[model samples]
Target: MTTTVARVDVVAVASPKRRRRAPGWLAVVPLLAFVAVAFGIPALAMLDGAFTVRDQATGATSYSAENLSASLRGAYLTALLGSVKLSAVSAALGALVGLPLAQAVVTSRFRALREAVLTASGVLANFGGVPLAFAFVATLGNAGVLTRHLGLTDKGWDLYSFWGLVIVYLYFLIPLMVLTITPALDGLRTQWREAAQNNGATTVQYWLHVALPVLAPSLLGGLVLLFGSAFAAYATAAAMVGSSIPLVTLQIADALSGNVLVGQENVALALSLDMVLVAGLVMAVYLPLQRRSARWLA
Candidate 1:
């Protein structure tokens, strides 16, 4: 009876469980709004115009594929092809020059020298457009300082021609390639080289079999980036050669400004879409390779 009485005390029941709150997504709202305003709206407008034609006389608009069709034909097509060729050649040359330059910088014993080269490359990569074109003109044009001093014009060197554009493009493209590929070069592990050497590999054999294989993805990614940079470039070419060079960007600008034709603004929009698609394709190829290369670095 005493034990039963002692056990009569009661305990309070536990409160009901509460749900955990989820993380807020409000932080991304500003970025989303900015993209919508700055890029999304303009992109939509371009897409709409690309497939539409307007009559300047009546100010009437209608849906049509004529603009796109026109973009793929005649001079427009030539401009597109020329742009591709220019971009490819510049990117290739940049890779050839920049890979070795990047290797030299990365392997340099002096920290100051490496820092100086990287800093200069960063500045030079962004130093394009009108000012860059002007610099080249002052240094290599018909009456340029170098041209006059070296008598290059007397040798029939034209700074306003296709080769001239390539040289100008290289001014920025090589630096851009260096900036892009430097990280990959640095990521190359010292241990890999030692291992190759221990296995009786020569310098060239080690590079060809091990180092190059590892760096290939990153190298290709950098090349694609350079190509896109050269492809989308407008100001430098415009300032240097104007429409004398048949480039897609120049063609787009001409159409928009009515410098080439009247009432062909839709054609310009179509060309813009085509450029976007090409860039998209480049990114499509690049992103996968970049990811693969990053895995090795990590």
Candidate 2:
């Protein structure tokens, strides 16, 4: 009788737990619905716009490849080239500068100073756009404080130049890379380092054999993020250099504003192409690196 009663009690306890877990999956329904409504709708609209054209005679919409093709040859191509160049350069610089900073901070004895630097970097990473543009201009533009003090009134580098944009971008890029790389650095097992040291491995050998392999995925991920951020960025580029620098985002803005290229169908197509190209590039780099990382981490 006691054994039977114990079995009955177990069943009763399990019943409510199973029932409670059922509703947990239902919570995802709202999130999925939200994404379908918000992201799915907008993404489809953008894709549809890429192929849509307006009839000059009747003002009716129709499909046209010529619009997308024309953009591919002119402003779209130029903007893409510029974007790639800018992103690549900035990411390279970030990685070069950030890795050392990450190493220093992670291995530092001065924890307070390291924390302060990390906090400052975090603040600056999010501190781009109009205010950043104005700040740079105030310090580096014509008749600015630094320019005036250094007697560089005429020869002072204008904040409206390509290199100027790069410099401003670097201010944020370096900090972002450091933030991303630091987590990877922290994940490095001290055991592995000690093992390598005990095995009579040189510092360079240890880094090349163990640290680099382990950190590869995080490094690649950071580079991809940096590239994507730079590529899609508009505010800093627009505010700092305006359309004179001829970036892809500026061209898109111009298309919308001026209603250029026949009802601005080209703008949508151009943006689609831009997104697709970036997606493709990132995937190309990420998939191979991810596979390698998985294998290594296994």
Candidate 3:
């Protein structure tokens, strides 16, 4: 009888525990709903529009790969390639420059100086769009004050061209990379350096093997982030270059605005699909690198 009562009590305790655990999944429901609304629905719409077409005269709807296929050729291809090239260059340069800036900030003795630089970086990283474009144009454009004073226009500096766009992108990308990599730099334990020194490993040797390996994942992830940022940018490029530069984002705008050509809505959708794929690819690499870096830093 005593054993039976003990078992009954155990069963009663387990029931409450199960009931408490049942509602735990409810916390994740809102985030899942948000993802479905924000990303899933738009993705499905893009996929549907990218492959399906409507007849202009007959009003018939049919499914075909023509829109997507078309996005891979001619001007579309040029825009896609140009966007990729720009992203690669900007991302690469941002990582290279930001790494040193971040290191300098991390190693600085002055707390106010470090905080000021970080604060400025946070603001500048988000400071893009037409305002940013116009600011750069005013300072760097062919007839601007700086351009006139510096004689950059005389030296053939064209703000509406590819290289000028690169410089503009770098302004934000470098700061963003600094913000992304600074945490990883801080997570570098002092013990590691002390241990390296105890073993007669010079600072260069210690960083070459110890620091770089640990930082590699974070650096790559930051580069991917910069790439995606530059890839999807539209307003800045639109305000600055218009159709002079054949970026994919600019192509999509032109296609959707109906100012360039007719029947380009499908092309716009196709290009959006391409962007989604590229973003998905970027996330795939970034998430793994982030996880790996977290393991080391945490």
Candidate maximizing TM-score = 3
- Kindly provide the TM-score of model 1 when superposed on the true structure, using C-alpha atoms: 0.90
lDDT of 3 by residue, 1-298 (tens): 9999999999999999998987888888999999999989988998999998777788787898888888999999999999999999999999999999999999999999999999999999999999999999899997788999999877888998888999999999999999999999999999999999999999999999999999999999999999999998989999999989999998998888874454556888998888889999999999999999999999
Winner by lDDT = 3
Instruction: Put down candidate 1 lDDT per residue, 44-136, tens digits, no spaces.
Output: 999999988888899999998989999999999999999999999999999999999999999999999999999999999998999999999
For candidate 1, the lDDT comes to 0.92
Name the lDDT value of residue 85 in candidate 1.
98
Better of 2 and 3 by lDDT: 3
Task: Name model 1 segments beyond 4 Å from true.
Answer: 1-24, 55-59, 260-263
Clash counts per candidate, in order, are 0, 0, 0
lDDT of each: 0.92, 0.81, 0.93
